[model samples]
Target: MTTTPFSVGTFADGDAPPFPGIVVDGRVHDTRAVLPAAASTAALLTDWDAALTALQSFADAPAGAGIPVGDVRVLAPVQPPGQLFAAGANYREHVIQITVAHRIGAAGASEAELRQQAERELDERAAHGEPFVWTGVSTSISGPYDDVILPDVGEDFDWELELGVVIGKVTRNVSAEEALDSVAGYTICNDISTRSLIGRPDVPMMGADWLRAKNQPTFFPTGPYLVPARFVPDPLNLDITLRLNGETMQKGSTGDMIFTPAALISYLSCHVILHPGDMIITGSPAGNGSHYGRFLQPGDVMDCEITGLGTQRNHCRTTEH
Candidate 1:
């Protein structure tokens, strides 16, 4: 499938600019000051096939007549999604850390014991290596360069960088082989979380419920731009990295995933219906806060990047109640 090539830009320090050759009347104005309204909007708005088609026509216009690619302010490819789905423990190393952290107390178990227990658990889980999925509401979505608000209710904010997939069409019960067909593109996402909410003891599930921690508003920072699936022939072989205030924090690759994107889509379709504009965060690699004793603090900055997809930079701030 061929996708129209589009450029992404962000405001240097404020609201999106409205330069005539940049973005005018809410649509991108190419170099000739010709407004391809639909294309500009379609890139950000999904489930609007007509708009996307219009965008293609606009992009095809003579080079000079097209919007000046460098003029417009580019924000995250998709501002909000219809549904945001996330997978947990999708990597062997991550799962091991989660299991040990949850089962053993805050004191943390010995490395030898942790490894032994993880090995045993893996032996059992390998037979049913399925993705553990959860949903994040639309309110939690933030732009790649937007600020990530740390809730004042807790001080255990953390970060998990993962590859996020954007659904292009409505789909249900799709096979693993057909999964890529339904994907429109990919982006980088930082699953900012609060450990206090995730580790709550009063919850009926005995802290088994991590949604509260993971689903805080503006917690999921995604995109600089969505690289059309065609640009990335293999989503499972990219490098991923996370940094805190210019300091390297975590580094790994999609190759470490216990469940691939195809398998994850297949597993999710068995229970829920996915549609255009939906998002699926494929899970992170090792070195998350829960495992390394590192947690996010206010005023901290996080920069995450995926090989094919672009970078996402967000500053930590206190969330007002």
Candidate 2:
């Protein structure tokens, strides 16, 4: 079957063009054209056959059915996900860069110290390197075009652009080959974070959860649209890039991931029941703000793009106290 282009947007009146956008099952609709609408796309995801049929019809319909992308504001595709899973150190270079950065600059430790630290950390991780890590509540999710607010409570704010997968079917103990069949679609996610919060030296126990650091309001700017899984011939072969303002910050490919999506799904399935509308954010590549000697500030615009998934532009703004 052919792939469908899934979009969510507000429809403009007869004369104006329709706003093209995408939405996950249940999310807050931001388009002024559309009244306050909160709905979940989960029902549409339970059956791949029905979901694909609906998406195909939607995509075939002309630019207006009261679903114009131009009129409606595009929010993160998924809403109230059952699980927001993430991969830590999924990219080898990122792991190296993060470790090196923490050791030399913030951690104030020598190479040997860093190596020892990383080894000890890895040893602990190795013991528990199961599937994926489940994050906190949905309060941490945000739209792709939304402004990333820097928390006044923290100093080290960082950005991580990752390719997010939206699950379609429920399956447990699925094999790597079977994993791909569960994917509903793909979208872009910027895992905005507060390094200081997760990397505090005083909280030796907390260490860096990466999950908490990455989940903040307006932190996961996703969407533009959800490209049906069939469209992605090879999920691992896509090119992923991140730009600050107009300057390129990260240029890499999904091929660099330490664990493929299939592997991740297989591993994750072993631990928890995978269900529809669950999200898995493949780890970000190198050139993240933390590793590149930069941190987001008020007014900075971040553009995150993945090949085939489209681009999501996010502006950095501080919330008024």
Candidate 3:
């Protein structure tokens, strides 16, 4: 793909319902109108290289082809990827934060000692550990600007803004040396969490309960754009910023990822085949709501951004029981 702004979305004109659109600047160019074959974002992903070529041609066409991105509702970038792969504790600082909490209950570990152990573990994991990959249901996805319906009980709802990687090709056991070739692009993903519900108390030894805590409706607010790989010169260097109610809550960078995008792809592919449109959202950085005890509440707004990919603003609401 060239340096063309390649963002695919679903938008409707005057309540006519939504259609796949290629977002260029502030305007939305219809993908179905321009190229019938590449009608939906999923369809476009099936052959990303060709779809990108078609998009490039349309982008260079005469100015009268698209309409302004007015008040049309912007749906999730596409249907949820065929598989959603999320990395856990992939950032060095994130490990530190998680470690501090986990070891806080340890009998004799000092705070400094806990932090040191966490840092050391990060280095060892990056050098020899396989990436920890988890699966998420696609139903959790909502529009980029959609309202997040918080559960009525879990009071520790938090925000974790991370970069989402969109796979473009069929890849199996691909080497890290050539993993970038399989990536289609990147997007912004907020892995909203009900922190208190992560563990299963009844099944004392089963470990994390990802499905219950992370798969609630509107739990994952994804994408205002799908920035093609070519546009993001270095995925590891982008800045990630997220604010709650206009107050900066999470501020970090992809550079801190203990498992880089390539590493995660290579390690993950060694086990399962990655299909086109599969997403691997690299883990969130430190400074989550847990850090400051500033968990999300109804009426609070979250503004998340990942460099050139774009920003997403979501409001929090709780439906009456």
Query: For all the candidates, what are their Cα RMSDs to the real structure?
Result: 4.9, 6.0, 1.9
Would you list the rank order by lDDT, best first? Answer: 3, 1, 2
Model 2 gets an lDDT of 0.69
lDDT of 1 by residue, 1-321 (tens): 444564322322235442222222233543223344423323433444444454355555524443433344445556435688998877777777676666753256686687678877776765665668888887888777778877766667889999988787778998989988878778888988887776556656664556777778778887766666766888989999998888888788898887788888888888898877688999888888877787887788888889957677788877652
> Residues 1-321, candidate 3, lDDT per residue (tens digit)?
445555777777886857788877678877877679765788888988998888877776634647777667787786645789899888888889878877853579998899988878778888888888888888888888999999875669989999999899999999999999999889999999898889788997999988888889999899887778878899999999998888888899999998899989998899999999888999999989888878888899999999998889999999862
Off by over 4 Å in 2: 1-39, 57-68, 102-134, 200-203, 209-212
Candidate 1 deviant stretches above 4 angstroms: 1-62, 65-73, 98-110
Among all windows of ten consecutive residues in candidate 1, which has the lowest summed lDDT? Answer: 18-27
| Predictions in order: lDDT | 0.70, 0.69, 0.85
Model 3 misplaced stretches (Cα beyond 4 Å) = 1-4, 62-65, 104-106
Evaluation by lDDT, superior candidate among 2 and 3: 3
